[model samples]
Target: MSISHRQTASGRPLRVAPAWVGAATPVAGSPADHHPLPVRDAVWIWSVRRFARLALWALPASAVLYGWFTLGVHVPPGPLPIALLAGWLAAVSLIALAGLLAGSRTRRIALTGLLITLAGATLLLPLAALPEESAAARVALAPGQVHTLVEAACAVSGAGVLLLGWAVFRSKLVNPADGVLLMLAAMTLGAGSYGVKPVPTVGALLLLAAGMGLAWTGGRLLPRA
Candidate 1:
């Protein structure tokens, strides 16, 4: 008997043997048939999840750097600092997505859009790092223009975090207190100082709290299933 095969949407190939072979094939009641995650796909998913979990730690580290900067410790304007901060943004967005996978469709869509917006905001960091009057053509933007662009990026990043916080609150998957802390953190973290001293400092503290809280929450719950 000739055998045929078809691929599932998951890209796993399913054998379609002749009717006479049905008795020999694995039954629907078999454990393998009930949960058919192949070894390769399972490994890939586990690796991604592991990376995401590890990335969440970046939040706390980034918070410390941000705290230092906002508290008047001068970090020289450079690409390294900007890249590190951007990486934290990406990490937080990924963690948020991972946590809310079981949430409502609307929440998922909104979170996805927010992640895209946050990514756009992240791209502005390298531009913000450029000096006002650099010898290189890449740093052509005027200082004022670069400042404005960075501020805009900050605004977008804050908005994305705010929306995500709201969605997390609505989902009620985690502690209500954690959700509230997240909202407060996003609010303070996003504030633009414009030369004001205490405002940004306090925001950084809140951000630190938010980061620690999220890391704790993820550690407690994310490893299951």
Candidate 2:
């Protein structure tokens, strides 16, 4: 159910390893357990959790604000409407990020949460965007539409990379538990490249390669919980 293991990485671009629990350690109500929180480690984890949430919420909130200001005032599928739509998508992505966050925390709880969250996104995104898309659904967007959506969404991903990269490589905010989630996110980006061209021969292969690379890397470096 866990989307990815939480990483102890401080600051790195991609998850350089797999994430897994090393062993079943002690828990409260067990023989020697007494504390409600791991006072020594819990504080740091809490702060990391908060930062992750803020980072995710930022993109969607901005887009939502922009949408309200621009296209919400008029019919969608127009100039500002297009931009707002992209923003809404960014919000959905942030929700996914939140799932990753949960997965990185309590494992069992995260599994059900991630499933429900992604199930909704997978179903809803296509339905919402199909109206303006091309029959092929490639950059079926009109001239400026693709550019607008692509750029904004990519920007959100880019910011996430920068911030999370810093946390994984430089800061110690991420532990090994979260590495896989990050790598998965990176792979998804590569997959979305298909939206740009939808050239199955090239795009599909690229996405596959990227996803495999992420899987391989995650399996290698992170602990297999």
Candidate 3:
């Protein structure tokens, strides 16, 4: 996302608000906090909700990645997937950043765009599963076209996941653990790209494994209320 700062008439910082404040406000106190804190509860609740969405997304994403490796999926002999994924991220981030510029009133619109982007991306999996949709037909590469697609996509996803994480962290939209769920996102990316490097594939699998572990921990720790 683009860096934003308010400027005075003189061009110095105008002092609008810190990166930490956003949609959710701090309620006085909760049973969870021994001492009252403003946004702590809201933050955790938002995180759990976000995590649930991703975990749902991950199931199909995993299947798609697996097909990308062992199935008939192909990679572009050229550099399309990486570019495409990066482009998608850039576009999404731009919209989100624009919302940030508009202030609290426009935040919902910005967030809606982001969610749309994610929803669109998730839909790609089922379509990609089809023989016609596979990258194999698009560009004929060496041997492992599908694998290459996965790896490149993963790298792009890691970049995106990290950025989303930062967005959430700074916005105080969710807890740190929520960001941990995004780790699944990174591996989801890696799985797409894993075929490029065997070791990296292992690492990607490890990341997915770790993500599941963290998700489990999150479920245990998250408040039922």
Tell me the TM-score of each prediction against the true structure.
0.64, 0.29, 0.35
Instruction: Return the lDDT, model 2, position 9.
Output: 36
Taking the tens digit of each residue's C-alpha lDDT, what string does model 2 give over 1-225? 322223233421222112221124456366533323323344454455444444453443443443344323565455454544544654454453443334343443334434443444444344335555551265545645644564454434434433442233332224433434343443444344344433222322332333333233332332222
Ranked by lDDT, the better of candidates 2 and 3 is 3
Better of 2 and 3 by TM-score: 3
- lDDT value, residue 95 of candidate 1: 59
* Reference-based lDDT, each prediction: 0.56, 0.39, 0.42
What is the per-residue lDDT of model 3 for residues 1-225, given as tens digits with 9 covering 90 to 100? 332233333554332122223333334364322323234444554564444534433433343343344333466642345334433433433343323322334354435535544554454443344353455655554335555554454455455444544454344333445445444454554454434545444543543443444345433432222
Per-residue lDDT over 1-225 for candidate 1, one digit per residue giving the tens place of the 0 to 100 score: 323234445566643321211123457667544444344554555566455445656666666766666665555674467546745664564455444433332456446646755674665557655554541346566656666766666767766667666665665545456556656766676665354677666766665666676566655544322
Worst window of 10 by summed lDDT in candidate 1 = 15-24
The candidate, 1 or 2, that scores higher on TM-score is 1
- After superposition, candidate 2 runs with Cα above 4 Å error: 1-47, 59-63, 66-71, 74-111, 132-225
Clashes of each: 0, 34, 9
